[model samples]
Structure formats: structure tokens, C-alpha cells
Target: MEILLAIIVGVLYTAGVYMLLRRSIVKFIIGIIFMSNATNLLVFLSAGLVQGNPAFVNATTVDTSHLADPTPQALVLTAIVIGLGMVVFILALKYKYFEITGTDDLDQLKQTDEHS
Candidate 1:
């Protein structure tokens, strides 16, 4: 199962990089999102999947035995939030591009050649 997860994560990262190289703003944004998810998954896998007790302070010391690392979960949450912010910024940039130029194509954004 762990190996499978690793494979899936690797695939996602590869796809993300390929898409990110494209000139389209939307595809780049999606690629960033996929990359973030893939990274988060890798962190989760590395943290190890334990099924003991929760890492709460209120609970008695039942036995940390094998608790899934909470650090990765917290990190992933922050990463997801950051990814959302990036997406919003990319979308806003795309919107501004369309409003100013009336087109979404990257090749059409040549302002140096066109007399504005």
C-alpha cells in the first residue's frame, strides 16, 4: 500500500511539472495545486500510518505505541492554504489579463508588437 501511494504521488508530481511548463495560466495553476497535493501525500506517507490513540493532551497515556505524526498533518494544512492563495492570485492575474487584453491566450499577450 505504501509503495502504491508513493507511485501515485510520483505520477502526480511528474504530471504537474509537465503542465506547469505550459504557457496557459489555468494549466499552471492546476499544476501547482496537483504538486501541492502530491507533496502533502508524500509527507503523510513518510510520517507513517499508525493506529494507536489520538495525540491529545487531555487523554491519558494509553500508549503512543504507533501514532501517526501530527506534524505532517499540520504542515499539509498550511500547504493547502498556501496553495489556495496561489490559485486565487493566478486566477486574479488571468482575470486582469483578460480585462486588459480581452483574451486568455499567452501567445496573444504580445504588447510589444501590437500598437496599444
Candidate 2:
């Protein structure tokens, strides 16, 4: 299972990077989404996939021998939320860019290169 997931992550990264290098704004947005998802999966997998109970201490004595770590889960969850926000902001930027220039092709952005 871990091997399969690793392979999937690799594929996701490759696709994301390929899309990111394209000349279309939509493809760039998709690439960002794929890359973010791949990153999140990588982080989650790095935490190990041992089958155990939740990290909750019960009663007086604290026995954490077979408990699962919660930090990675929390981190991944937070990252997902942040990634969603970032994607939304990027989409809004894309919309504004299109509205202003009426073009989604990144190559057309060369018009602004003269100013810089």
C-alpha cells in the first residue's frame, strides 16, 4: 500500500509540474492543486501507517505504547484548509486577469514585459 501511494505521489508531482509549465492559466491552476495534494499526501505518508488506536490518554496512567501520532494528521488537515484558500485566491486572480486582459494564455502576458 505504501509503495502504491508513493508511486501515486510521484505521478501526481510529475503531472503537476507538467501542467505548471504549460502556457495556459487554467492548467497552471490545476497544477497548483495537484502539487498541493501531492505535498499533503507526502506529509501524511511520512508519519508512518501503523495500525493503532488514537492518541488519547485514558484514566490515571498514560499508556502511549500503541497510540497513533496526532501531529501529522493535524498538520495535514491544516495544510488542506490553507491550500483550499490559496487555490481560491489564485482562481480569483485568474478571473481578474482574464477580465482585465481577456486572455488566459500566459504567452500573451509578454505585452507587460515592455514595462519591466
Candidate 3:
């Protein structure tokens, strides 16, 4: 199960990187979102997944032996939210660029002295 998860994660990372190399601004934004998700997954995996423990303390128990590590989960959760915000911001930038320049291709953004 762990190996399968790792392989899936590797594939996601590769795909994200490959997509990010494209010239289209929209694709680039999407690729960045994918890459962020991949990074979050890698961080989560590195923290060691618990088999069955939840991240809450038991009613009477005080020791921290049986509960899952909460830090990684919290970190990943925050990262995901931040990633979503970044995706939204990047998409807004893309839309603004499209509206102002009429193109989404990075190579086509050459500034002209007359068009300025």
C-alpha cells in the first residue's frame, strides 16, 4: 500500500513538473496547483501515516502514544488551503493578462514601443 502510494505520488510530481514546463499561462497555473498538491502529499507521506489512529486524545488517556501525529496533518491542511488561494490568484492573473493583452501565451507577450 505504501509503495503504491509512493508510486502514485511520484507520477503526480512528474506530471506536474511536465505540465509546468508548458508555455500557456493557464496550463502553467494549473501545473503549479498540481505541483503544490504533490508537494503537500510528499510532506504528508514523509510524516509517516498512522494505520488507524485519529489525531484526538482519548477521554481518560493522557499519554501521546496511540494518537496520530497532528502536525503533518495540520501542515498539509494549511498547505492545501494556501495552494487553493495561490491557484485562484494565479488564475486571476491569467485572466487579467488575457483581458489586457488578448493572449495567454508567454512567448507572445513581447512589448512593442507603439502598443505601449
Sort all candidates by TM-score, best to worst.
2, 3, 1
Off by over 4 Å in 3: 110-116
Per-model TM-score on C-alpha atoms = 0.78, 0.87, 0.86
lDDT, ranked from best to worst:
2, 3, 1
lDDT of 3 by residue, 1-116 (tens): 66777887888888888888899888887778778888898888887778777877758768768677889898999999998998888888888888888887867867663465
In terms of lDDT, model 1 sits at: 0.79
Better of 2 and 3 by TM-score: 2
After superposing candidate 2 on the true structure, give the runs of residues whose Cα lies further than 4 Å from its correct spot.
60-62
Clashes of each: 0, 0, 0
Best by lDDT: 2
Residues forming the 10-long window of minimal summed lDDT in candidate 2:
60-69
Give the top-scoring candidate (TM-score).
2
Question: For residues 12-42, what per-residue lDDT tens digits would candidate 2 score against the true structure?
Answer: 9999999999999999999999999999999
